[model samples]
Target: MKAKPLRRLFIGFLLMAVVSTLSVATPAHCGKCNIHLLTGSEYFYALRDAIDGAKHSIFLAIYLFKTDNHPTNRATGILNALLKAAKRGVETTVIMERSDDPESFINVENEKTGRRLLRAGARVYWDRPDRKLHIKAVVIDHHLIFLGSHNLTHSAMKYNQEMSLMLNDDRIASEIINKISRFPKTPFKRQP
Candidate 1:
């Protein structure tokens, strides 16, 4: 009788240890998160690839949507990918930040980028001025989400050591999509 009781206690302790070890191995809810780290040009490649491969829609929100276009430049490759994605019937929507002083370089360059996107059939919106819209994210088809510190600028593309996290989870993606849908839109001017 004593041996039987001791064996049961040992087994119970072992089970609890195993359970605790597994649970504490990583942060909570990490099983479903599937986050992948993206750094530097890897960010650009994955973003461009996702836009290129998108079947239904692409949603982009950025602090600065500035890029230089040249045939030999990889930055232009990203811009062209967005345009081509829209041309292929992908419902592409972009939300960018706008300041009250439109003459600011950040605002001016962003507007120029917006017009190019507009001409290519991408719907562009400036966030409401009550708050600064600085979120940088891209959601594709309600399945993939990319969020990071990167601004779509020449420096970000060429020099800065930027970081982004790519998540592929439908539940999280749906939540993000629903939240983004509520952002108030501001007027965008078309360039002549």
Candidate 2:
């Protein structure tokens, strides 16, 4: 009868609606990708954990790595993690920003932090003074990457609202490392 056909059509439409909703809720192309969208203070703990767990290597290029003596500052914790990673024999490399003017705040802060890491046995390099290396990126073990606007500073990590992504993609990580490798290792006079 006509009622039976109408019922079947309604059931089919209901099934399609459910299917569409399910597809909309879940992405279809996410196949082996694991990504975390970090916002605000989330970057601090995630980066610290990655550095703490690094077994092979940690390559970091940052615009700023200003560290302070604040006991609970998140950026300080991340800095300590890098130092520990270096001490544990992980091949740690840090490329920092240097300004054309030596007395700039970013220059002074980066130098202080870079020296601290160097004394802890990490290899540190200064980017060309003419070009600003304003990259806040970390490639850990060549398998994980942290890239975004979150600088390694107390204000950026703790107070200011920031966003970053932690992705587990080797190809992207390699590309980032490659880009960082090309940065000129220009030498600058260190403060005694």
Candidate 3:
């Protein structure tokens, strides 16, 4: 009788191990795949295209967005695109770094951009932290995600060596959106 119970327990354990292994191997949304790897100019073009094609929503989390009065600055163009998207009923959100006074040039520019976006019916957020928000990504319509080292700056798009991945999969987009949703909101105070 004891032997019979031991045999049953061993079988149960083996079945549990197999189930665990299969669960680990098979993730949700297995159809999602890496469609394109963009680099240099192609990366920027892909980003621009994704931004322009956004239909439902646009979420941008960048480290910097230069708004200085320079003829070659591309921040203006990016901001304009976001504004246009907002105007067209596409919900837009820009999460940028927040700077202090005396060094508040970027902050000032971002404030103006935020006002414009709000007027155009878009939400804006400034990350207040000692360490910068070093993520650069744009999630559109919750169906595609363009993410990598490209920032919303002129140099990143035109001169700097950059790389990005254009993932045309709903699974990947959902994962990115979930991660972004977990980020802390404003008035972030570090806890000891």
Candidate 4:
């Protein structure tokens, strides 16, 4: 499949992930929330699912949200999912690494990506540029959370091996949200 079409299909899948939220869930035993151990593509898919299904908010604290022009195009792919959720009035916000890797193209493209997200109506925050915020986390609708080592990059999505947890727990999610609220915020600068 061509990269552009694959990208479009990923967009469709993201829309379905949100619109068909029921598919992402199963009956929980006696009110115990569901949790899944996501690895590889499952990890990224689950993140997309949660963001798509979000009714209230999506908060992301990512280490790197880099994009590439490869055929896989995992970089720009995920941004569509994020912007879709934001367009749906999901209150999407991203807190990206402040001190980006000096030698990383991912870091450079991420600033550009942030600009795209801003145009898409999402709030993008850069964590204190003085310090490195090496976290990859997402909180959706105050209940679901994804945390792990996956960067929002093509390698992390399709090529590299990565691990993350998909959880449906409001207690811990709330606590994390409160903690994120205290993190020093750095404004995103639009690339000229």
TM-score winner: 2
Q: TM-scores, in order shown?
A: 0.79, 0.81, 0.71, 0.76
Off by over 4 Å in 3: 1-30, 68-72, 99-109, 187-192
When summed lDDT is taken over every stretch of 10 residues in candidate 4, the lowest stretch is: 22-31
Number of colliding residue pairs in each model: 0, 0, 0, 1
List the global CA lDDT of all models. Answer: 0.82, 0.88, 0.73, 0.79
lDDT of 3 by residue, 1-192 (tens): 899999999999999999999999966573745668877677666666677888899887777776545755676677777778888989887777665442466666556666666777777776765546788888888877778888777777788988888877777777777886667657322222
User: In candidate 3, which residue pairs clash?
Assistant: none
Query: How well is each residue in 157-192 modelled by candidate 4, as lDDT tens digits?
Result: 877888888888888788778998789986777433
Prediction 2 TM-score vs. true? 0.81
Q: How do these models rank on TM-score, best leading?
A: 2, 1, 4, 3
lDDT of 2 at 146: 94
Question: What lDDT score goes with residue 159 in model 2?
Answer: 88
Whole-model lDDT for model 3 versus the true structure?
Answer: 0.73
Report lDDT (Cα) of residue 39, candidate 4: 86
RMSD of each: 10.1, 10.3, 10.5, 14.8
Instruction: Between candidates 1 and 3, name the one with more favorable lDDT.
Output: 1
Positional deviation of residue 109's Cα in model 4 after best superposition, in angstroms: 2.4
